[model samples]
Target: MVCDALDLDNEEAEEEMYKLTRSFVNPHRNFEIPTTNQVFKMETGKNDVSLFPGQIVTVQIMPEVIQVSKKAIPVHIPISSPIRIILHPMFHQMTYSKAVQYLKDKSNGSYVVKPTPKGFGYIAITYIVEKDKAGVSVGLRLEVEGCKYIYSDLGELIVQYVEPKARRAEDLMAHAKFKSSVENLNSLEMNPNHSSYGFCFDYEMP
Candidate 1:
């Protein structure tokens, strides 16, 4: 008798789920997962200095062996994340150490525009915009490679340090829109589209 009751309860639960998902069962819709980029307000310089078109930057994560190389210079980065490669047309391809040395030369050792890694497929690309005895700060972009469509890693370049801030009404509205969209998707039992224009319940039952 107890087993029969449990089976009935399970069936009821599944029926409730199907009813909840009825509105989202669209054959043409595809669900999109949220990328990490949505978590941060990405910032950068007005005149960016990243690689030019058709150029690829090399990122290095395990920086131990690189320490012994003459081309590599140790940069005191406060962030312990995945390294990235930011390049220019002038620098098509280079080793991780080489990229660090290149930046060290440009900044006169004051800053380091180097890439760090956050393994698990996330990258920490940074441009060292400020340096001092107090602390070193860098503008960063976090994302995995080849997934720019799913997640665009907007590397930061500079930010305001000392200033009284006011919450802008426009910013608040934009944030509210994101929250509303998320809630709508969840309530509808649907996934958002890649373009964020639609939602779908595309899961298959085993």
Candidate 2:
């Protein structure tokens, strides 16, 4: 029964059957990054890169270690398999190379395309948005394949720092200003002409 299903009698038939079966399953599963100190470490302390808006950065993949032998010798390997670039909630149905080119053209180079090395010779690239309000670099934050990590350029592990406590004062001031403005606006008598207009934020709406 096994031979009939796998077609052991004919090598050509077996190859065809394998391909047919593979079509049903996704070839590229999601890849995640390792973050433990025992598993990885950052290679550099330099954590800032000035990336402009609409700029696309293409990063090369680095080789990574998979396992350590009983003799305490680490085994390193180069990535050989293909990778898929994740865009939205779902993974794109294309290779990383094609996806990178497609995104570069689609966004007119408004995205950062930096591929980092995951352990075991698997590399995954992450997309970063460089906006005016979000330009603070806290190392390379990756959340691909439902995994997150902060790593150096060489793919070693690192820690991600939260926004400084100093920003709290500025945040409080901004909130106070917004509250004051709303309170002052609420005290104003509604202009009958302006209230009759189709303004979406009309405070005179009963």
Which candidate should be chosen as best, given lDDT against the real structure?
2
Tens digit of per-residue lDDT, candidate 1, span 108-181? 22232233332333323222222211112223333223334232223222122211111232243345333334
Judged by whole-model lDDT over C-alpha atoms, candidate 2 comes out at 0.33
Pairs that collide in candidate 1 are 51-87, 81-117, 82-116, 82-117, 82-118, 83-115, 83-116, 83-117, 84-115, 84-116
RMSD of each: 44.7, 37.2
Clashing pairs in 2: 41-157, 54-110
- The list of candidate 1 runs beyond 4 A from truth reads 1-95, 108-120, 126-206
lDDT, candidate 2, 1-206, per-residue tens: 01112222233544554544343234462222322322321121221342322222212223454686667667798887565453443233444555455455432112233333333233343232211111122233433223543454322221121222224323543452332334454544365543332211223321
